[model samples]
Target chain A: MATTACFMIVSRNDIPIYEAEVGTAPKKEDAAHQHQFILHAALDIVQDLAWTTSAMFLKAIDRFNDLAVSVYFIHTRLMLLHDSRNDDGIKTFFQEVHELYIKILLNPLYLPGSRITSSQFDTKVRALARKYL
Target chain B: MAPVAPRSGDVIFASVERVNAELFTLTYGAIVRQLITDLEEVEEVNKQLDQMGYNIGIRLIDEFLAKSNVSRCVDFKETAEVIAKVGFKMFLGVTASVTNWDAEGTCCSLILEDNPLVDFVELPDTCQGLYYCNILSGVVRGALEMVSMKTEVTWLRDMLRGDDAFELQVKLLKQVPEEYPYKDDE
Candidate 1:
């Protein structure tokens, strides 16, 4: 079984900028929609917790059975859903994603709170996931 | 002791950090295309770009302050110098020459010899009045506003619009005094 399941990047406005599934688990017909609902549901918890804590990395904020979600909040919220219990590895993943997000922000053309549709950005994210996830 | 000569803007920017010019140019092109498609009006595009730049500038100022570690400017002249030498160099990897100071010294122009955002860009003749580089001016205005220096920034010349040089004019309107909202009334 793959340790990592799904990765998603949600903008501050609660829009999903990017989403990818890294696990080898067989596809479920409703899995994509299910993941989207779960991700949005977790966001409320993230916002409530954000006020009390100043940490960028919020480890294991929510879970459903074996599935767990880890969040990193900078200008946007980067969430990772996985089956494995590697706390340290998930932190590294979020860190790398945050770096790429900053690079995207540096682009004069790119706007904050917009969908990230750059193919180059997508490719880089996948490469990072393959390396670390 | 006599004050040491200030380093030239070019000298300070000589070894400044750099990013991929192609990435910058391509991303800018994509953004322009998207704006045109969505707005469908040349004038509207210009306004949107300026608004976007203002938002970016407000956030970017934080990064600039953290990285440059420079103190607040004593005056508008010094502010212009810092924007040209330090602000532009640190973020854009380019230095603009500050020139054409008005008689009052509250207004000046920044001459950009090379603009990475306009590399390989050609403005359509139909959009003659559009300020392709208006975002730069917006950034200046937005950044200055944050420092309590309310200023007006406009593009005096644009290479994309067939101008000989890229020039941005900045005019100081007034400085906004900081207000403490929670102070008790005497």
Candidate 2:
């Protein structure tokens, strides 16, 4: 399904954290160490999907715009399962992610479908992307 | 412990001063026609849309946390409840409830009491089987799945239909990550 495809783009990004866990590097894999990485990745995906869909909805009037957006959102959630431990910490992390998104939406300059050219937007997105990347 | 009320601005059509959908659609059509004669690829368009949705989800979740102040859901049922009530209310001004919950609470039907996205438009023959404006399903599925619920969202009935109501069936597929690092312990 198109929805599945859109979500895959988000879930695939987590493969690295798993790789990081496997590596003998400094970030050793403790019992729940990977939890944060997984949660952050999911948070990033949610924000990304929301921004992208809002942009598309603004671009045109299509019958399937909502559906398309929904698919992408679902995919981002699906991708988050890889690192979640069903713990309280994960829940709190999502709450924080939710708060971050609301802040972004409140800003006036970052209109839907625009380039998201705001320095603040770029900085926040870059921070998340860099962490996940 | 107290339930959080949704803000005034989050609801769709909450702003009467803003442009209406009909007028907006007309303007959008004219603009698209003038700008790009050949539309881009559907995949490319959807990709762009996903990216946009990603951004919106980020910002929307931020507002949700600040306003609702609710923490995450511990299980699938909790996640579904939170999403249907808090998530939908904050974003779309609708509260979808799960009626006829199955044995495991995995198979459930969503009933939308009020929807703003389909307020004015009729589902023409072209858009029948399509989900009119339920991108939240993807967002919910993806967002909650990240919290640990493996969810599969399917439409039992499209929103644009003869009945005054719409139903979406959500099946909780299974636990996520077939081969998680902690699988051996479980």
Candidate 3:
């Protein structure tokens, strides 16, 4: 069975603004909360690496056995977790998401560091996942 | 005051470099769409745009000063001229005309003939209260505030809203004196 990809958008304040799961990875009981815990735990490693490197794309920053985590940071943090080792696919997905993220920032009503609850934004993210993830 | 030379804008712009317009436009488009979806009220959106622009402006001035190699202006009029001729040209690759001065000569308008940020953009009916170019006003306000000038920057007209042209009215409210909190005990 193919492992599913977990995508998360964490705000500057460390709150997860958007979260989605794509692909058919066999689900285990309590996997949702487990994924959240894994993502949050990885944040500490991400923070430590950020001070040492200037690259926006931090590939394979951490891993737990078969699980690999990729991190991208702009004004906020984008984290991707997957079992596969396709670095190129992960980079492309982050690029498209970054473009969408900047567009959201342009809205007069949308402030930085706030939760993104727009359905339109959610739809666009799903489409990108289908195309790339 | 007498009008400055027309080609000054051209001279300043020619010396300045350029960036890919697509990156600028697409980024701006995404921001506008996001703002519409997140904020339900138009008035709130307007205020937010100004606030955001102010933030951008504050930092942008530092870059403008470093790259343009221009000195400080003696008065508000000169400040207006530099912003129109140099600041806009350097950043946006376009020069706005400084016009419509008030009687006290402390207020003026920067009339923009073209704005690259709103290229291929049309205001949807649902976004009636949206000020598409409000960030520009905020930028000006924020940049000026950083220079110790307290100015009220407002939009007089916006082509994105179907106005005849794009105009930003900048008024010099008062000069804020720089307060030095740390002083040696004498």
**Most accurate candidate by TM-score:** 3
Predicted candidate 1 versus true structure: per-residue lDDT over A2-101, tens digit per residue:
5546888898788898888876677788665777777788999999998989999999899988888889987688988888777777788789878888
Residue B141 alpha-carbon offset, candidate 3, angstroms = 0.4
TM-score of candidate 1 versus the correct structure, residues matched by position:
0.54
Q: Chain A alone, TM-score for each of the models?
A: 0.91, 0.30, 0.91
Q: What lDDT is obtained when candidate 3 is compared to the true structure?
A: 0.82
Q: Retained native contacts per candidate, as fractions?
A: 0.04, 0.00, 0.04
Best by DockQ: 3
Q: What's the residue-level lDDT of B58 in candidate 3?
A: 99
Poorest 10 consecutive residues by lDDT, candidate 2 chain A: A1-10
Q: How would you encode candidate 3's per-residue C-alpha lDDT over B112-134 as one tens digit per residue?
A: 99899886565545677778888
- Which order, best to worst by lDDT? 3, 1, 2
Q: Note the residue pairs that clash in candidate 1.
A: none
Candidates 2 and 3 compared: the better one by lDDT is 3
- Candidate 2 off by > 4 Å: A1-133, B1-63, B177-186
Give Cα distance to truth, residue B62, candidate 2, Å.
Answer: 5.2
Tens digits of lDDT, candidate 1, B1-186:
444424334454555566687887777778877887789899999999999899988888887776565776678998898898788877777788899998999999999998888765555445667787778878888898888889999898888666888999999999899876686774
Alpha carbon lDDT at B68, candidate 2:
66
